[model samples]
Target: MRVGIIGFAGSGKTTIFNALAGIGGDVAPGKAGRINLREVQVPDARIDKLSLMYQPKKTIYASIQLADLPGQAPGSGGGFDANSIAKMREMDLLVIVARAFDNPYINAPIDPASEIGGMLAELLLADYTVVEKKVMRLRKEAAKGTERDLFEQLFATLEAEQWLSTLELSEQSLELLTGFRLLTLKPVLVVLNTPEDKADHDSASELIEPLSSFEAPIFALSAKLEAEIAELDPEEQLAFLAEIGIQGTARDRFIRAAYKSLDLISFFTVGEDEVRAWTVQRGANAQTSAGKIHTDLSKRFIRAEHMTCADLIELGSEAKVKEAGKFSLKGKEYITQDGDILHIRAS
Candidate 1:
């Protein structure tokens, strides 16, 4: 999954990125767009336990790609460049990093809630612009007597653009609009960057007045503090977070939450050669998920036998697991559950 981090100027977007991805982007305000891509291992307690139990030659974990997009200050008109918008369009999820700390002399410092409200408006405007442009093109095509079904459908959607968000369209309407790729329709994750001293502040209460209309989940973190904490040794990091009364790392929570937001889940393929985790959407069945591993696996697909990692760990061995009659055979239509260890049999 590709997650793009964006916020207003001096919102500590890069700090959040570095904390999450272990990158030290310079701490400068008003910097232009600089895209940083990093693959983050998806933390799973079950995987760790299994690795310890098996002592395999190699231990592999599932991973997702994160993109640290530059800070976007739409109020200053410095945020949305053509390239930046295009980059955002390529993301599967958006992480809006909001500034909640006070920094004297910062070029842009506004109420985090207010800033986020304005940012959402800007995103909506950007989508509206795209929709308007497409509508105009379709109009020209219609005037020239073009009679494509897709264009006609697009024209109808463009007419209802004012109430697009409110229209609870049927499956058919949704399927028709799926190809448009409207940015406003994408899921949003709001990350509120708080002061180090107040990292655990109740953002829901703090943001109640300013963000009453926003329906997205809000996560609070100390971006600058987390970035500094991440640079320390693992032991020191744990000690530091404990001293600060932090129970878990924000990066892990962000990644896991982002995974859920994108409707993604993990499955595993284990062997002495390589035991690796793979990601696919939650509802994806066996055949569709096999395609994620390799086209060849999907092409030669027959049936899949499945067992849970938990069952294997409890049973002590694969031999014992099979002997216990826990293994089950599933057809292509079998929807994969998270933590399932799959072995596909194909001819």
Candidate 2:
């Protein structure tokens, strides 16, 4: 999955990017509208235990492709630049970094709601423009088909200053929008970048109260602190996080949030050669999940021999689980569960 990191200028989005990707840099705003892309493995403790159990030659965690785009100035009045919008359209999800940090350089007081509201307005406007133009073109063509109907519905929703994601779009309407790539239709996660000194402050609740009606999930973190922690060794990192009363790094928290927001789940395939976590949309069936691993598996799929990670850990071995009749054989239509270890039976 790919997630775009975007926020107004000086929101410390690049700092969050650096923290998540374990990279160190100046965190300066990008010129030339360049996007810094990084693919970071999603940290899974289940995969860690599996690695210890199997001692695989390669233990691969699921990954997310993060795109750190050039920051737009707050209340720029202009919509997203074409290049930036194009880059955003390719993302599976958007992470909007709202400024809640008290920066001496910034004259405005920390107001996360205003930052979030402004960014959301921009996204709505961008989607509105796209939908309006498409509606106009369809009208000109005198097209009264399902495509036109879908665009008109979207145009109306955008006109109401509401997100397309909030509308109950049908499967057909959704398929019709496959080419439009409307910004408001994508899932959004708002990240409030808090001041390092006030990382645990209660003031964040007041700042976020205005956004209580928003459907998107909101998170608070000190991007600066996370960046600093990223520079430390693993042991020191754990100790530092414990010192601050945080359970894990910002990366783990954000990844878990992303997974939940996107309705994603991970299943594993284990062996001595490789033990890898494969991500799929939640509620995806066995056949569809096999397609995540390989098309051939899906095409020739018969049944899936599967067991939960917890079951394996409890039983001590696959042999023990099978002997205990805990292993399950699921058909192609069966829904795959999270942490399932799947063995495909394919021709």
Candidate 3:
């Protein structure tokens, strides 16, 4: 999945990006309408254990593509540039960074709610403009079809300042609206960049309490602190986190939140040669999941030899798991679960 990091100027968007992507050093301020893309491996302890047990020659983890888009300048008023909006429209999710930290360079007070409110309003305005223009074009051409009706419905939602994602529409309507790439239709995760000295402060909660009405997933972290932690070795990092009484790094929390926001899960394929984690939607069935590995496996239409990772771990090996009757044969219609170890049987 692809996620975009977006926020207003001085909101610490790049700092979050660097922390999550494990990149360090100076990030030159991005120009308006530019996108910085990076690929990050999704951390999974299950894969690490499997690799150790199987002695695989190659081990691969599921990854996500992250785009760091330039921040919207405060009071730009006209909304985001067309290029930036187009890039963001292609993302599966958005991570909005709002500043709650005091910076010597910034004169504004640390008001996360207001920053987020302005950013969200701009997103709504951008969608409204797109929908309005589309509806007008359709009307000018006197168009009469599913596409026009779809735009009309979208326009209605945008007019009310409601996200299209919140509206329930038929599958046909949804398919018709796919080309529009409405910004507000995508899932959002709000990140409040708290001050480093007050990383565990209760002020973050107060700042976000009013935004509960939006009902989006919200988290608070000290991006500056996280960036510093990212520069440490693993052992040092753990010690530092313990010193601060933080359970985990911001990267882990952010990635987990991103996965949850997208409703994604991971399935595994294991062998002596390779142990890999594969990503799929939560409700994907055996056949659909096989396609994620290989189309031929799906086309041949056979069964899957599967067992949960927990079973394998407890039983010590695939042979032991099979001996215990923990390994079962699943047909194409069987729904795949997270942490399932699957072996496709095909022609």
Poorest lDDT segment (10 consecutive residues) of candidate 1: 144-153
lDDT ranking from best candidate downward: 2, 3, 1
lDDT of 1 by residue, 217-247 (tens): 6778888877887788879878987887787
Off by over 4 Å in 1: 24-26, 77-79, 107-109, 143-180, 201-212
Worst 10 residues of 3 by lDDT: 24-33
User: Candidate 2: lDDT over CA atoms?
Assistant: 0.87
lDDT of 3 by residue, 1-347 (tens): 99999988778888888888888554555355566799999999999989989999999999999998978775555567778788888999988998888856566777777778887887888899988998999999999988888889889988988888888888887777688777888899999888886564354577667777765788888888988888889999999999988878878888998999999999999999999999999999999999999999999969999999999988889999989989899999999999999999998
Top-scoring candidate (TM-score): 2
Superior candidate under lDDT, 2 versus 3: 2
Of candidates 3 and 2, the better by TM-score: 2
Per model, state how many residue pairs clash. 0, 0, 0
Which candidate number maximizes lDDT? 2
Give the Cα lDDT of each candidate.
Answer: 0.76, 0.87, 0.86
1 or 2, which is superior by lDDT?
2
Candidate 1 CA-lDDT value:
0.76
Candidate structures ordered by TM-score, highest first: 2, 3, 1
